[model samples]
Target: MYIEQLKNKKYSLGSYIPIPLGFILLMFFNFLMSDGVDTNEVIQQTISMIGVNLTFVVLVGPLAFGLLLVLFWVKFVQGQTLRSLTTSRAKVDWKRIFFSFFLWGTITTAMILVLYYTQPENFVWNFKPEKFFIFLILAIILVPMQTSFEEYLFRAHMMQGIGLATNSRLIPLIVTSVLFGLMHIANPEVGKIGYIIMVYYIGTGFFLGIMTLMDEGLELALGFHAANNLVGALLLTADWTAFQTNSIFKDLSEPSAGFDVLTPVFVIFPILLFIFSKVYNWKNWKEKLTGKLIVTNEIDTVANDSKL
Candidate 1:
């Protein structure tokens, strides 16, 4: 039983409790530290919010709220080694990450290209070499923080918590996937594209969740996500997109949902999944994913004694 694995594996719930709470406190600290304590400081508020999120990403490992929580669970709670936390003791698969990064990157770039070709005048072609290079450097440093923060929160902390709580794979998968989508509701893209685009956002969560659950570790998901955001932030920028930092290209093209929108959700995602499944030789996914976690007395007995 998967739940039994939690106990037999010495997994504990205490580690999960503080991470989300700590994140909330960190966010409050960010809000309090922001400049101008007024009703309408939009720019300041935005900067502070981004700052808080990125800070959380950087601290996740050190603070045990993000990737750190996963490490804590494997190391202290489960008494497992570091290799278990990172790769589930399996070989790191670089091809999976590369295939996903390029595949998704090309799909997004193609959409921008089509839009640009159709409406050249709409796009300013504002490529300033110096500014764009500066943006690239910032992205190399910060976007990983952003993507890692979200992944650690959703896939690492929340996924593990729900998996332990419900003692079933399906509930955690659904809960984390939905929560991950909700977390992105505040991004500027949502307003421009309307709530309909949430299907894509939430769908991406589901896809990532499937990857995590199937892989039994965050390595592939981490690589894929880091690559996705890093490439996107560096490759193009649009007026409507959030994080309007300098990039190699400014998307002068108007954004709209087309086959481009559906390709990732409907096509690329499934292909990536198939690719991973084959590479990992993932078997009995239904069992590995949806099976119940049966908590046993063996590990819990010792865990309970530790409290005394």
Candidate 2:
């Protein structure tokens, strides 16, 4: 029914197709037009010249604006509400959003602390009081826009659009997950670690998709994503990483897609899902993940809108 709600919206595979294409075109055009910012250029000099805080905004701003454009289209053109885009519940669940945020935020931060202490030599305390404060303000405001854009595009819009088009839960789940990973193929991590790290990216997609589907909403996924990026931006900055920010510490280790990356995908994600299932009491594993998406014609008389 959550997926079926898209039927009432101005949503079709065709309609949804152009959003990402336009986003990609806009990014390319911006890249070409922006002076002295080269995607292919040396990473350190660019960061030094551009300033870490400004560079962080430049990398993330387009996706954030693109998400705004999509939200506008969803509201005006599609005649759909943000609550509908977010969840099947009566309204957006802010509790679920922050719950998932702090839950994963704790786990992620703890892991980073362990790594930091275990290999202190690999991390440089890059905290400049003034610079970090500025970076903090920008990261708090802008990082969510970046993470939310990905979640909305992949888990909210594309997941629903692809499900409606294919009329199957499994296909959309897989397609959107893989496509989400593919979207990050150009990230600096890919260049540093090679395509071998795609396993981590694609695995992350699968985790988010599973969370979105099983939770029957994007709240959990949104929180998890925001926490993941937000914590990373605040705790660590790396030359080869995407969010090259003036965070508390800078990673100087050689980047690799070894156990640190693979274990999370194969082990930690499943553990987190299991914990979520227990807490949320999620059942119907087989049906929910791979079931047919039947359109429900439930009418919400109070809101004067139809629900699926």
Candidate 3:
């Protein structure tokens, strides 16, 4: 039913081309700018002048770019509603958003505590009253915008568009997931932990993708991603992490592929999936994930045949 909405003439597969075309235009501008001045230098210069806590604000840049383009294309070009882009439900469910946010936030905070207590030597208290509050304020305000951009773009916008283009659920799921993961290749974590970190990134993409498909919406994915980044920025800090903010604690140890990384990918993610499936009353193990979307004339044909 979610994918079936693509049958609207305005959302026809042909209109999907503008989504990538817009992104390419944005990328071209980014590249042209990069040729003249080192973007990293500009960032570092800004950080040196504005203090490192504002780095989170700086990090929101690319997400902002992606968000603007997607919003314009979806709203103007495709003439789509935000509710349709986000969910099968008639409205955007704020309750579901906060529920998944707190659920994953609690789980993530618990996991962080487990690691800190079990490996006390690997962490240090990094709290500074002034700096942390500033970081918290900035993170609270700006971080959702960052996470929202990613979820809406990769999970909602691209996922739905690609699904329409391919006329199959499976290809879009896999494509968006891979793109989501590969998009993170520039993250500092990848450099610190190597490609093995991709397991977590790609696995996260899969987790989010499955949740989207099973739930018939992006609300859960939105909350989960917001919590994943927001809580991490608030509770933890590390030099190797993308968000090297002033957090309550700093990870002193080097980045590595370990239970912390693998457990979520292989263990906890599956458990969460099972829980979500039970709660959402999702049926059809094979069809929803891989079935061909039967919108357009197929429904008309069925209706006509039933008249006999």
Candidate 4:
């Protein structure tokens, strides 16, 4: 139903090519340009030059603008309402969003605390009150923009577009999930921990894609993502991580592509999916996720003939 909303005269799959093509080209160029450079040193130098807060703005601001641009394209170019783009319900569900945000936010914070206590030596107090409060304000505003941009692009825009083209939920899910993972190939974590970290990134894409399809809305995915990034920004920082903010603690441990990278995808995501399925009462698993699309007219005819 959510994907079917894209079935309209104004919606041309061709018009949407430029957005993703541009994104792919950007990532490809970044990989080429940073091929031999010491990316960690580059990140550190940039942070040192501009300070952490400004560096954060420089990194996140464009994605925030990107979120706006995507919305504008959907609204003006595609002639789709923001509500239709977001969900199939009569209106956007703020409660679901808040519930998901609070749930994941709690889990993430608790996990960080457990790690901090278990391996106290690996972490150091990195909080600076003056710098932190400012960073917090900026993060609270900009982090959601960055996260929302990803969600809308992968989960909503591309997912719906691919579903419209292929007429199969499974195809869009797999395609978007893999593309979403590739989108993060240039992240510093990939360099620090090796390509194995891509399992987490791509798995995260699958997790979010499954959420969108199952829930039939982006509220949960949006909330989960925003909380994941926002809470992490406020709670932890690592030199090897993408967001090197003045958080409450800094990780000094050596980064590795180990079981930890796989645990979230293999263990935690499945558990969360179970919890969400129970909470949302999702049904029709084989149909909702893997079924072929039936357009409105066909559905009407089927119902009419069944009654006859």
Candidate 4, 140-234: lDDT as tens digits:
99999999999999999888888888889999899889988987777788788888998999899999999888888898999999999999999
Q: How does residue 23 of candidate 1 score in lDDT? A: 61
- Model 1, 79-191: lDDT tens digits are 65554333332344456556656666676678667766786776666567876766566667666666766777777666776777777788878987886776556555666
> lDDT values of the candidates?
0.62, 0.80, 0.78, 0.85
lDDT of 3 by residue, 1-308 (tens): 56676565455566667766566566566555555454445555666888777676777766756677777878887788877888776666777788789989999899899999999999999889998898888888778878888888878888888888788899989988887786676566665677798899889998999888877788889999999999998999877676778899998987658865687899999998887776667678688799988665543211111110
Candidate 3: stretches off by over 4 Å: 21-49, 296-308
Write down the RMSD of all candidates, one decimal each. 8.1, 4.4, 5.6, 4.5
What's the number of clashes in each of the models?
Answer: 7, 0, 0, 0
Q: lDDT score of model 2?
A: 0.80
Distance from true position, residue 56, model 1, in Å?
A: 15
Q: What is the TM-score of each candidate against the true structure?
A: 0.71, 0.89, 0.86, 0.93
Which residue pairs does candidate 3 place in steric collision? none
Residue clash pairs of candidate 1: 2-293, 3-293, 3-294, 3-295, 4-294, 4-295, 123-252
The lDDT-based order of candidates, best leading, equals 4, 2, 3, 1
Index of the highest-TM-score prediction: 4
lDDT of 4 at 267: 92
